[model samples]
Target: MTTLTTTRGDITTEHVDVVVNAANNAMRGGGGVDGAIHRAGGPDILRDCITRFPDGLATGDAGWTTAGRLPARWVVHTVGPNHGAGQRDRGLLESCYRRSLEVADELGARSVAFPLISAGVYAWPRRQAVTVAIDTIATTPTKVEEVRLVAYDAGVHQEIASSLTMATSVRILQGVRALHRRGYHGLRVNPGVAPSGLFWRVVLTDAADPGSSVRYTSADEAKFAGGVVDAMTTPHEVAEQILRALPRLRPANDAPAYAAWFAGLLAAVEPEHALPVSSADYFDDTDGWEIGWNSGLRYPAPPLDADSSQ
Candidate 1:
């Protein structure tokens, strides 16, 4: 699974294996992404392009060159179809991303950042361009591990993000609830971005610290089943398969609140063949997960959709 992350940021500052440039058919530096890439990457990129392609590259195709002053190791330059010039072939637009990934694979690049091709001066509709980028990348077969769609601003970022199906966070919390690996440990449900693109960082450890040291009644003792979240052991799992991932995953906080969550789940698990569940009434408005699974538990209120409110 090639994890896709859509964020609003400058592509030039992206520290990744490769950055895809929406270059013109000439391959020579011009305006928009073409000019920005060349300017940031310095003269070396242009020199490589000229030396590598004296006759220029064809439209809808891609090739690699050095990433001079930029943070990336290589630049995959692809010519996008100029929709403004009556070049409305969506295949050509899709080729930009597919071909770029091909080039990235050939270069052994694991992570890549892309700009919305043809959405600038080329006049490809911005919203459609985002869909194209996501669809093309998601369908293509490659060794690339991660692809980040770096939007030019917050507006574009919102479009890209909104285009994606919100990964269900409650599912992930359920997965974490089934802890088992090797070492004895406790659990922490943290929400953040990871290399594999999970918003929640599941921490399982027995380290002695201000936040982690309270397990034992003695200075050297510890408690509970010890093991890592094995779901992460495999590479490229999708957000849904993410310890089940991406819905508004605002699980209860681990610090101060972890003890209560742990105690409740432990008690619920004591019943044979039953998965643990929180005391629905204790939830109030904290975590947005389903309020109750116990038949006897009262229905507190409506289920909160985490991503919708965000």
Candidate 2:
């Protein structure tokens, strides 16, 4: 089983099978986790990485080095991306975790440690960045038994704690749906109801925190609104409609459903602009959430009212 752990300590002093150095493309010393690992592991680690990975590893790619003075036998060097949205950086960051695990598995290491990649001086907001890091770890099918995310400060620690909360929220939602399947609820969306052509559910949040309250709406509404706005005979007509819908939202945080729906809608609407649709690509996102679709395995749509058939 894979487990998530948090700690704050020198990666070198921590007694583990491997310590992952949140590294840079050069594999040389810079700041943050990179500098720390290079400083503790000594200059030889850098020299070895350079010799071993001469092609200049891309951001999110990883390589390995001897632990040097660090307590572990090997140090996996992974380059995380700088913070950005839908930028190539996101892909690179995902690659960082994927490559690191690959390196660890190749070495047959059972345990590994990671710093909050790109969340420090790299300017990735601690909250958003940590989610991506944790999500990447959770979704990977690698054989490592334990993965520790070492948070260096209170801010980073809180971020990791929040990730835990989000994961819990997901579990709770699953439980709710499961209970409904067992006839535990008075009003539940029938799991048997087949999805109707890329429906979206957007949850708007006032507080950005994962645990905050949220308001939900169907994506069909947004699509209708867009069409209405485009068709309005006068500017006032569109503005009036927007104002009428404004009060529907109260101050609250968006639930995970919001993000999941948006990601899916984007892919469904513009497949070219979205990330690749696969277990590998879905795990690559910060959400660490997975959704799949198959033409032959679909449930019957609304009128048919039949359960899914594989």
For candidate 1, the TM-score is: 0.55
Number of clashes found in candidate 1: 11
lDDT of 1 at 136: 77
**For residues 1-110, could you state the per-residue lDDT of candidate 1 as single tens digits?**
67887878889889999999999878889998789899999999999999998889888999999999999999999999888999988899999999999999999999
Indicate which candidate wins on lDDT.
1
Q: Pick the candidate with the highest TM-score.
A: 2
TM-score of every model?
Answer: 0.55, 0.57
Point out where model 2 deviates above 4 Å.
84-88, 174-310
